[model samples]
Target: MSALAIILVGLLLCLAGALSVRLAVLAAGFGVAWTLAVAFDADTGTTLLISLGGAVLAFVLTLLTARLLFFVGGLCVGAVIGAKLFVLVQGGGADLLLLLVMVPAVALTSGLLARRFERPFLVWATAFGGAALVLSGVGRLWADAAGELWRPGTTAGVVVVIVVWVVLAAVGYSVQRRRRD
Candidate 1:
């Protein structure tokens, strides 16, 4: 991916992670709608309409039920993690079934956790989601430097990226926790 694209993706991830509960409805709804529209090869206007409708529906659902919001937020966070993991594992020749399994497993686990832990869950989920995005962006940048898109670079480089991701996530988590307190 281009540097600009990487940056934009990173920023988006950070935003989603930081405000997951607030944005979950719109993100999940529009994301699913867009995916369906593209899968069906819908026209531009149709896609827009579908996405907007989905967003509105999601907003109403989430606004009406706090529990649903938590579940959806967790699902969205898990989906992000699942996608990142899928890409990493796919590079190792993982099967389609594995990808499918990973997504629901992560989503279910996260949803349950969110239900059980409430605010703490949101904080951690957002932190981890943001970290994953940051890691992916850095990885892409490294690959670009090496004339590739997703190539895993040296072990040292990988370690550095992971360390940075963890630190940033910890900071985010702390900040969110403090805000809640």
Candidate 2:
């Protein structure tokens, strides 16, 4: 992966893990900003500018219209879930039909979940999203180091990654819940 991709992934993991609950509005803002930056294929400098702009926009919009912030957060969370699902199902294949179907479905499901259960949804979504990003970054780094795609010599490596991801996500969730209480 490029340095930009690594940086973006690291920022996402940090936002989701540390700031999602304590500073939910800020996290949501940054999440939306990062998503837009990536979607637009902004260069590093442009991406930074867009991210900062989005953060300010999110903060202002959040204060002016909290519901809108929630909706935006839901949309960002849904998009992340959709992207992850697409990666898993695509598997080096290009199927427009599958993409069309799966993307909307996952996004809608996640969005609805977020709308229905705002606090819990944010907590879990952020944690899982962070974990997913961390795992993805690690996988990409491993691939770069090994000069190949991520095919572990044994299942142990994959298992370890999954375990670590789950543990990290659980820790994030617990920390957020405790803070909330």
Candidate 3:
């Protein structure tokens, strides 16, 4: 039940995150709380209370530290860009020294870019993050319910999941971009 709730909340984020920053934060909190609640095997009442608590926490935190969150989000975006760049560089048989140089450089560049374009950055960030969250919740729920065999129950399941995530992310990105404009 809680797992399903997480999935629903994640879906909301994936589809409409950029419509409202507060909604994105609250949805993230709702998904996280429900995901945790699934482990507790609690009654519906307790789960609802926990989810509400999570939302309240999200509200308070966002109210208190919106700017900090934006900065941190920029840093996080930088980290992801750096990681991807690292992999691309590694493909050329790059060495440790190059990695040490490249990652921070890319990260710094990305952070600067994010700082200059906060809304667009948030849209992309929320889209991908929401898709990932949805995938996680679905995977967890599927595994717990089916025992052993995951999502699609076959190797093709992996491909399917990846494709689905990409599509979701893309759609979310488009929707958020439109909304932002």
Each prediction's TM-score against the native? 0.61, 0.59, 0.47
Give the number of the best model, judged by TM-score. Answer: 1
User: For each candidate, C-alpha RMSD in Å?
Assistant: 8.2, 9.2, 10.2
User: Which residue runs does candidate 1 get wrong by more than 4 Å?
Assistant: 1-20, 23-64, 146-161
133: Cα error in model 2, Å = 1.3
Write candidate 1's Cα lDDT for 62-178 as tens digits. 768877667777888878767765665555565789889998888888888877786668678767776677666656666656322233445554455556657877876877666
| Clash numbers, per candidate | 0, 0, 0
For all candidates in order, the CA lDDT equals 0.69, 0.63, 0.67
Q: Candidate 3 residues 47-151, lDDT tens each? A: 888988898898899978866666666565455445533543353465798788876776566556556776677677657656766776676688765322123
- List ranges where model 2 is wrong by over 4 Å: 1-64, 144-164
Shift in Å, residue 83, candidate 3: 13
Candidates arranged by TM-score, highest first: 1, 2, 3
Give the clashing pairs for model 1.
none
Q: What digit string (tens of lDDT, one per residue) describes model 2 on residues 1-181? A: 5734853664454345334433556667777888888898888888877777877877776667655555556667666656655655554666788888887777677667777776577777767666566556666676667311133344555455556657877876777677667
Candidate 1 vs candidate 2: the lDDT winner is 1
**Model 2 quality (TM-score):** 0.59
